[model samples]
Target: MRTIAEIKESIEADFMRNETAAKLYGFTSGDSFAAFFGKLSVESVLFYLFAVAAWTLENMFESFRSEVNASIDKMKPHRPKWYRDMVLAYMKDRTLIPDTDEYDTADMTDEEITAARVVKHAVADESDDASLLTIKVAGEQGGRRCPLDAQTESQLKAYIAEIKDAGVRTALVNIAPDRFNCELDIYFDPMLLASAVESTCREAIQNYIENLPFNGEYTNMALVDQLQKIDGVRIPELRSATTVAAGESVVTAIDARCVPAAGYFEMGDVKLNMKVYNG
Candidate 1:
């Protein structure tokens, strides 16, 4: 970047140097207006030139820096292994998913694609020579959580393909829904019932648990605190939250946490019994 002193020197050397411009000013050479202290008009003109030159140089540097930064971002690697950032950006592109704006990606494994909202991993065969890259998305379709049917998945695949390199290939696999049964015994203020606070608390807790990231840890204390945030719930408690996973009834204790193996959490039976108690 050019300094203010350098710009000022350059402007002073070239200011009003043309034949017509110099003749009209009655100036044979710029050396006559060297001393700015006595000549107020010359001093003001020089100051204005310096200001203009400084402004121009500053803007030039800013533009240059912006261009360099943009170039660096574009130069970033978009290889198959470096898939998170590129895939996330592609998923958020409005052109790719014009119908939906609520979905977001979460976890990702070496072999499987894990996301908070929707996505699935296809089983890879180690014996095969070729590799299969599969991604299944499920989200708000017709006001319900369902797989990104053939048409939507195809549209997303087209966009993803365009972003990938020429030799790379990706496959779209069908994702299965992972459901968890939750039973909540909540305590709240009955006075807030007029505002439907009880029902609101139940729904809020259910949504929070259901929408947690795929394979993300779920804590019991977090659920209780989130429930208490509802307007009508003064003191919210998560009485018992148990899930039937792999033919086992796994209970999430007050201090415990659990994560689903795949897919996002599904609300099985969120039984909320609100009690009026303020402690």
Candidate 2:
């Protein structure tokens, strides 16, 4: 049996040959690599090959487990329903969460979706009933060249004033610069800034705020927009959220996309440290 590295080496040999050929035949560097060539990059090809190997290994292990199960199933004539549920629960935690970037952008498949429903219920049983926290951030930074042109303190102060008028409470809004982006990070007293703003800033703030590069899964708050003037428009996902305690450093949640229907994520995915702790 070929080792995983051996199989990858074999793959690389074929990939190198094609790349060498394409380069020799004037395939420019900026050409669509996935189409004109094969993979997005050398790293992408390697990741895909590894994913295939991992999937293959998983299937092989499952086959072995089935043989074990056959022996056990034969001995147990009347297996309780709880026993079956326990077995299923064990497998759910044991299985590796699929590699999202390598397979699909959405990172979900049919099997994973059905598997998630079971996992969701089980995880729900373990929660301690926590309320969500919001951090309101300024969109500008002083040192870094900002993503947007209006990145001054005055611009941010003005924006906050308007955001407050739009029904978001920015009274104690803690703002700071992210070292890399040099953008002001905002955390609300509560975590639902965009949702609150959606209610108040029905007309004025809609157009401008929509264009901001946000990370949350944004929807138009108008189940019925109370005013006729604020009809039929939606907000994009508000990205780059941060949270900070009094005198403590800011922590930003990664993905704040909570579909009210999918009880799976009441809040978003959060990382306490991207730099110091991630180190």
Candidate 3:
């Protein structure tokens, strides 16, 4: 990663340190040689040559390093992130050539299957069963994450089975977003109308929930902090927060932080109790 200028400077320093070369070139000191190299005349052949050599060497070194790193990555065993990436890269209706484990790319273009893939967001984690991976996936619909349709889910499951490593099992979780409900107590500036403040605060809450990373943790303190940043809000308190996992009806309280079981969450029932701030 050394810049061309740095490499050139290093080469000049090494050349100047050689007393024999300096004496042969009739240069008495390091400053004299540096002055000659710093000139822009056509006679400064060594200076330009060193610059060219350094640039070429730096590029070669970088290319070699990249090739080595790529080789190492290929040799590494499959991990959680790799599984997530594979799931996202899955193309529907693609036939895997038997024993090769690679898709039949003959007469097929990438654009053909791009629209067939329904899974847009994915997260992979280890399951309770040994050698088993749990992958949660969701598709985008109207700018929101949603579960894949029955047909698409079945196609994805079959694809995973074919490409997964031997003896490794994968559990696909394609479900609706978990439901988030909360009640907040907000004391706001009287100058701003209650309705306006309430509207802005509700937007902030919705944004915070929707923007969380796939399977990201949700914390009560973080939500309160987000509300406190809004204008015209003096105090923000989270009265209660609960979530119902997708496909389940029981509500569970979030003590500190909770990760959505379905890989993401949506706003369910939010109640903002806006009150005027009295000093």
True-structure RMSD, every candidate: 12.3, 23.9, 3.8
Best by lDDT: 3
Candidate 3: tens digits of C-alpha lDDT, residues 1-279: 776667667767777777887888777546544576545654345666777787898889889999998788666667788889888878777767787446666676667766755678999999655677899999998988899989889988888887777677788999889999999999999999999999999999999998899999999999999999999999998999999998898999989789999999999999999999996
What is the RMSD of candidate 2? 23.9
Q: Provide the lDDT at 154 for model 3.
A: 92
Cα shift from native, residue 252, model 3 (Å): 0.5
- The order by descending TM-score is 3, 1, 2
Off by over 4 Å in 3: 1-10, 28-76, 97-117, 128-131
Looking at candidate 1, what is the lDDT of residue 42? 68
By lDDT, the candidates rank as 3, 1, 2
Cα deviation at 207, candidate 1, in Å, is 4.6
Lowest lDDT 10-residue stretch of candidate 3: 36-45
Alpha-carbon local distance difference test for all models: 0.55, 0.34, 0.85
lDDT of 1: 0.55
The TM-score of predicted model 3 comes to 0.80
**In model 3, how many backbone clashes occur?**
0
Stretches of candidate 2 exceeding 4 Å from the true structure: 1-38, 80-279
The positional error of residue 21 in candidate 1, measured at the CA in angstroms, is 29
Residue clash pairs of candidate 3: none
